[model samples]
Target chain A: MTLGRLNHVGVATPSIEKSIPIYRDLLGATKIHEAFDLPAQGVRVCFVDTPNSQIELIEPLGETSPILKFLEKNPLGGQHHVCFEVPDIHAAKAEMEAKGAKVLGEPRIGAHGTPVIFVHPKDMGGVLVELMEAPKREH
Target chain B: MTLGRLNHVGVATPSIEKSIPIYRDLLGATKIHEAFDLPAQGVRVCFVDTPNSQIELIEPLGETSPILKFLEKNPLGGQHHVCFEVPDIHAAKAEMEAKGAKVLGEPRIGAHGTPVIFVHPKDMGGVLVELMEAPKREH
Candidate 1:
């Protein structure tokens, strides 16, 4: 199998509240989700639905947040990572490791409520990539 | 209308030749376009077709290639910009400007052969956003 589809693009923002207006008013996005904190991930996130994908806006939750370093260099905010869907995250991780790509950690529940893993940017040509298991559809 | 769809993610690479194997053999991508130079934009580009979108691999075309600076900061390369499709480039430009987002330059032809413009990263929360007119689909 191959990459399933683009799930979302993670944008690291200093203030999700400040950024919400741009996506909502300027871009005319109507399907934006309410902001929620992912305590484990140490970031507050909300999804802005696009025609084919979502923009995941993230803000550091507290001190020692993983995204703090990213924000330190880019105080205003910046694109953090690009997330893609995979039919099976385990298989996707296996395949990537076989090609010498560094899988950050074991598959864990991600913002999408699906098993996900991050690949090191160095391995993916300087782009931090997130691979999530595609959500199953019920008939 | 809202952002039509994510068209492609532009990645700056030192060498497109070197990155192809990872996306193809590793990621199982099969529909990669041949690499070509776009002197006007000061870079070479190639598209790796994903299931729902594309990853545009771009390399500096010459000594004065604009991407050279990005490559310097990220010697191994990095995600440069994410492009989205719009129904009307002019309307999108107007909406962004009205919202106080700086749209760079006049709309011009982009790598997709459609009129496109870039929103300054400062205005876009540190992520350079490219808005391209949606390409016509062939029946």
Candidate 2:
């Protein structure tokens, strides 16, 4: 599977509204998407784009959320994942699993109607990585 | 100061040799440089390069090394820093510091003679970031 580009960097924080301004002023990113109450994911996320890459700010909605638990000790912040744009998510997952890498989730529909798969950190030397195939734009 | 491109992603590991094959096979990167004794920093490092970016695998040299201490609890793997290429390292540091980001180090020589400085995670939402400027090439 061909890796296209570095898609985005994921960061887990305490609050998006508080963090957005800092990132915007420093990185010059514009907020492209914002959503709340993603109960299944247990967090609210805002997608901000810069010229070269995108930044994902995730804030936990409930106490039980993994990100919430992560923040208990590291209240300052945490690196979530480094996503890579792949031409084919399924093909990439298959290749990774074949090479003794564990696939965290099977390819499924993710935000923005794109097919994405998460690879476990255990397989990738402790860095959680995501492989995504962008959605086709309809005319 | 404008961010040029991402230079390298630093990954702290227990053993650079153990982790090299995985990155090589998965990311299509080839070994470019290896330093077994960084007495100044108390660690060993191997640089792997891909077409667009590089990955730095660092392992502590002795028990007293900070990386060795860090690996004790986070043995699975984790990011050390995400460095961005800049035209001027000191200028970038000054700009980031003026914006309230804590500069970890003054611009100094790092791998390949590149002048670099680190920004503390406190200001970057827990992600250790480095600013780097290219070295002059000799004939």
Candidate 3:
């Protein structure tokens, strides 16, 4: 259960459209991906690719979206959770729990279409950490 | 000024010592570096290496440390900033200002001893972004 590559850093944003130029023009990021909605996750997500790892821009999709609370606290949005790849999702979850870290919920399919589980921020140095099974191929 | 590698994600902590175990034992991170103080930045920093990038654990070095204000707002501490490498610091700064992004201050030597500048989070999709001159050789 060694630490793996950082998959991406999730950033909760109020508007993905407005945020695109910041990455594209300001940062000279040319590989900006299109924004899409994940109804089950209750968020619209976009990926801005860096040479290594990515920045995931997420916006609320519905009234009950979890990002709504974070937005309430930070009207302008902010850095959300960081996702890391793991060899096995179930093994990672068991290791986390055994180490006395709180797993947010049972392993479930994440936006990357792989099983993932989130570890509680309070138990993970105040950083919400998402552990996802490594994708079968480059995404 | 094209986007380079995702260098590291900075995590502010009240105590770097307390945060080490979280990355080490809990996440099975083996390449945790020794902590050191950067009096100029007023933060004690440590690096935890992952396959792709690194996680920087920062603890306030003194009462006047800038991180103190952030810690006051987020008592448990949290993700502070994300650093990206650039081929040229001056070019990146000019490009950002030209794009209407507010660069926090003139480029200065950062903890990594490289010229770096920070963009205002308000203008960066609510993410504090640090742009550093790519190191001459990997640290």
On lDDT, the leading prediction is 3
Candidate 2: stretches off by over 4 Å: A2-4, A27-40, A48-51, A62-64, A134-139, B26-39, B49-51, B62-64, B134-139
* Clashing residue pairs, backbone N/CA/C < 3 A, model 1: none
Which lDDT tens digits does candidate 2 get at residues B92-131? Answer: 8778888888998677776656888878888888878777
Model 1 Cα lDDT, one tens digit per residue, A32-136:
999999888899999998888888999999897999999998898988998888899899889889878999989988998999999999888888999999899
- Winner by DockQ between candidate 3 and candidate 2: 3
Ranking by DockQ: 3, 1, 2
Clashing residue pairs found in predicted model 2: none
Candidate 2 contains a number of clashing pairs equal to: 0
Query: What would you estimate as the lDDT of candidate 1?
Result: 0.88
Every candidate's CA RMSD:
1.4, 3.6, 1.6
True-vs-predicted CA distance for residue B9, candidate 1, Å: 1.2
Question: Which runs in model 3 stand beyond 4 Å of their true positions?
Answer: none
Which candidate, 2 or 3, has the higher lDDT? 3
Clash totals for all candidate models:
0, 0, 0
Each model's lDDT = 0.88, 0.72, 0.91
Instruction: Give per-model TM-scores.
Output: 0.95, 0.82, 0.97
Error of 3 at B93 (Å): 1.3
After superposing candidate 1 on the true structure, give the runs of residues whose Cα lies further than 4 Å from its correct spot: none
